[model samples]
Target: MDLQESFINSPDHHRIPLLSWAPQTPTAVLVIAHGMAEHAARYQPLAQWLNQHQVAVIAVQHRGHGPHCPDADLGHYADKRGWQKVVDDLQQVVVHARKQYPDLPLTLFGHSMGSFIAQAFTQKYGDQIDNLILCATNRVDKPKLRASLVLVRSIKALRGKRHRSRLIDNMTFGTFNKAFVPNRTSHDWLSRDPQQVDRYLKDPLCGFSCTAGLWSDFIGGMLDINPRVWRKDLPVHLLAGSCDPVGEMGRGFSRHVTNLRAAGVKVASERLFEGARHELVNETNADEVWHHILNCLRPETHSVTE
Candidate 1:
């Protein structure tokens, strides 16, 4: 396997960082869109695993969340059109990956916030890839999304987009830990592995509060999700942990699946792990999760219903 890292130019004079891991002869290309408050490097282990399976991996470090970012710009996607700009960054990475491996089918895998971006990407640019994978993603209802966006906008107006609100932070990242009382750490909901949780906490880029503008922009992206925009031929896999608060503990996945099928998606497959949490990729049963994902990437003759 070979590993490489590079930067690509995007709009607004911003440079997006990307990490690539691949085998000598890859059968497919997997492009990963990482979650908020984290960098693409965190997924290196997973990428290496996929590389062993003869799949090339390219992970696009989202704007404001990588090691290359300046400290002040760590949580800001952009000063304007932040959501669209982030999506555009993903597109740039996809174009780069296409150049590197033009003949292979590319699959987009997104986790948490990345899943939201992937949703917008597949809708506007579904033809760029052959398959979609969404993990630990929640159902987006317009009423709630609109309300949150409005609230974030109001806060931004009062304190500016660069401001971070403890209230919003508590409402989100803070609330997620409530289910696991007497938590060892604030991020216990991430996975069942204690060491992995520690590693996440130790990573400087893993935990940071997003600005109000970023939140508003992210919600706006979710609101912009129009089922009709998704390509019917694209095979989509929805993955979530039954204990994940972000997924509303499986309820959100159920509703979201219903929404996807209602949109006339023919090959939308979903899997909910029995006792997993938010970050299934980092969980104790991650190997099993990886195998399941590999199966999904397999040919029609293989079973993806593990």
Candidate 2:
């Protein structure tokens, strides 16, 4: 597999970093949108795995993420229009991938926060990609989300856009660790594997708090995409962990699938890993997760080629 790094110049002049892995003979292309407060490099293992299976992978780091982002801050998509700009960044990456490999069928894979972006992207550009994969995501309750946004916005107004609010962070993520009481780390909710949790904790970019402005923008984006009509014919695959708090232990995942089906979407498949956490790709049973994903991507094949 060949691994490469490059940068794309967004129209707003923000330099977005991308990491890509390609095999000698590729069968398909997968573009990844990573979850919040993390960089594209974290997905290297997943990318390498896909590459070895004759799939090319390209992953983009959001505006406030990765080492090459112009700003040194850990989280802040932008002072204004941050969420839209992130969506635009995904569009730009998709255009680039299409140009680079016009013949390969393209699939968009997103996890957690990235899954929200992927849903919005499909609503806007459903025709651009052949399939969609949403992992570790749920259909958020609009009322509660709006209330949280209002509170965050008020805090932003008082402390300024760049202010990082531990209050907001706690309100959003504090309870996730509650499920694993006597946990070794605050991020134990991320995976069952202690090594993965430790690695994430040690990574400077993995667990930082985002600016209030980012929270406001993210909530706004979530509200905007929640009610919009999605294309009925788009093929979608939803994956979640049975123990993932974000998915409400699979209840939210089921509701999301029901919503899509109600909207006339063709949900190709849905799977909930019984013992996994929020980050399915990094779980102890990650190989099983990958097996399910491979099956979804290549339904015609019975087994993954070595």
| Most accurate candidate by lDDT | 1
User: How do the predictions measure up, each by TM-score?
Assistant: 0.97, 0.96
Candidate 2 lDDT for residue 56: 91
Q: Runs in model 2 with CA error above 4 Å?
A: 70-72, 226-228, 302-306
RMSD of 2: 1.7
Q: Each candidate's lDDT (Cα)? A: 0.88, 0.86
Off by over 4 Å in 1: 301-306
Cand. 1 TM to true fold: 0.97
- Candidate 1 lDDT (Cα, 0 to 1): 0.88
Q: Write the per-residue lDDT of candidate 2 for residues 1-306, one digit (tens) a residue.
A: 667999888998888788999999988899999999888898888889888788899999988888775454679888778998999899999999998899998999999999998888887887898889999999867888989988998999999999999898788677888888897889889999999999999987788888999899888888887423776666789999999999988898889888877767889998888978999999998888887877777777547641
